[model samples]
Target: MIGSPITPQGVIERKRGIGKVEVEVKNMQSDKDREEDMDRLSDLPDFVLLHIMKFMSMKHAVQTCVLSKRWKELWKRLTNLALHSSDFADLAHFSKFLSWVLSNRDSSISLHSLDLRRKGCIDHELLDMIMGYAVSHDVQQLAIEVNLNVKFGFKLHPSIFSCKSLTFLKLSIWAVPWMTELPSSLPLPALKSLHLEHVTLTAGEGDCAEPFSTCHVLNTLVLDRCNLHHGAKFLCICNSNLSSLTIGSTTQETPYKFVLSTPNLRSLSVMRDPIHQLSACDLSFLEQVNIDVEAYFNAHFQRTHLALISLLQVLADYVKTMILSSSTLKILNGLSTSGSMITQIPCFVQLKSLKLKMKSSSSISDEGVSRIVEYLLKKCPLAKVDVINCRE
Candidate 1:
């Protein structure tokens, strides 16, 4: 009976004592005093504050003004403004938010990059307004990816082609009017890199002018999933300084054709198109050629394979390194009339290295692989041949 410290009443008394202590601590500070203390604690330096704001979207950063008077104006001075409306309920609301942000942006804006990937279709007027803002701020990089459905037929503003300070530009549109053509003359002298995805390159009405030929300093060009319809000729109008070119998913029946007149082109990668025949003008200066042709197994596949072999025969004489990955290697294995024809691989005499990616069940037996190796050894005695199973 030493004070019965373990009793239930003793436990209740200890709990009451803790509650009273917490109440006393809470009563020492009023709401106004706590808010003032928080305000003083949040007074970050300008550079530190800008860095923090950079992690937030323009809309959320702007909304912080409701937090306090000091934060209300801090977002206005941010040099970088990125507006993304991916979570908005509709395009109208997203557009209204963008309008509000643009209206309140500082006049002495240091904005250098603007990336807008809104989920809904944006009208041309709204796009033009954003482009105008980007130009006024001397934006150096602009990337816009829009999923414009076929029903809407959205078009980009022509004024966007004139941003003089833009060095890198990437544009992807799902559906657009065939009548909407690229600007005939790109005035962006500083544009060095360009990527076009799902863009239609139609020959404009009247004498079609090559829009990209004026990009004298352009060094990289990539075309993916582009539809060159209505007899549009894929021409290399500019890019004399181009060093890398990638052409992927061209229409097989559209007879897509283009010339690579760039004498400095170092690498060329082409992927999966039946139009495998390259004209004399294409890749004349290429030092390395990587061809990944999707073989259509049928009468069409046979014909296409022969055409591609002819193309390889042409490239074998000039290309220092050749890489081939596709079902075409299986077709080549079937080309040997007899085992003695192994010496025919010499057509690629200039090849210093040859990489052949074959499928495990690609109709290429161990014997067939050995035969092809012998043929290659005869043609390029000093060449190194590496075979890899692509399926793995």
Candidate 2:
């Protein structure tokens, strides 16, 4: 056995044995090195990891459970949860997944934000349970966009209105031909931002209470195509702390009146619609005004023209920047010919920037627009004017 006239076959067998041993040793070393290496992701603190996972969808966050033992339980501590019903195969699967997540998630950590978007069939019970969970967990921001099923009479969990820690709440309900009734009282004292889309707000009449009056500290309010259901006759938005307000409704005319009492409003943007009888208290603090009211110019020109005048009168003195729709030029051209009211137009004392937004459908000629610009320039000679043309 000790090299007694070794043949080529014997030498080859010995070399194979040496190679096998070397491979085994290398495998052992590699395994040891892998075991010694620490997972960089697992090294992150729970809050940091959770924050990073916020950018990922809930499904991907849950999929991280397969990565390692540490990640198995890490997803349960996610503070920002975004759950979409469409992510699952069916409503039942979505419900089961949601239930499992809610039951297993660390309830001690206060939820930072919960965004739930559902496009398909309505699940009122699931929605209520989710709201209840969010409310109980001190959710700071809650955004819910669901397709409304009017037959079921959809209602938000009562605890949402009473959440002490809630700061931002956005509820956008679509697919409902009729406006959804609002809860009589929304006493969310801590709420700062409220965005409502396609929902009905009933003014305080009889048992119903004014929805926005209690939002004392609300700073940003966006009302997109919302209706002021007239159980009371007037819809008053009287939040003194409101700084940014956007009212986007396409309805040409409505029976109810809108009253705004925001003394500290700094930014105002109204697009598409003009409230029939909107009366605003002193807006002396308004810094920027964006008025894009060209939708109903031809049909209801007179009323819309008056509303524009009123709005400009209220905002002219303090507005540093003004964005006017092309229809405004047409209105001004018409007003100049009609009477001396054009000269009575309020001067823009604080105006620094003036933007004329022209749309493709604008009927006003370039000469007319120039004339209107001349009139406005007389009012705010120091303000720089910029013309922007938009296609639809």
Each candidate structure's TM-score, on Cα atoms with residue i matched to residue i, is 0.73, 0.81
> What's model 1's lDDT at 249?
66
The pairs that clash in candidate 1 are: 342-375, 346-379
Off by over 4 Å in 2: 1-38, 152-154, 175-177, 206-209, 250-255, 296-303, 326-347, 358-364, 388-392
What lDDT tens digits, residue by residue, belong to model 2 across residues 252-293?
Answer: 245456678889999998876575456786888888889877
Question: Candidate 2: which pairs clash?
Answer: none
Number of the predicted model whose lDDT against the real structure is largest: 2
lDDT of 1 by residue, 235-282 (tens): 444567888877776543545555556667878777775463555555
Task: State the displacement of the C-alpha of residue 360, model 2, in Å, after optimal TM-score superposition.
Answer: 6.4
CA lDDT of 133 in candidate 2?
A: 97
Write down the TM-score for model 1: 0.73
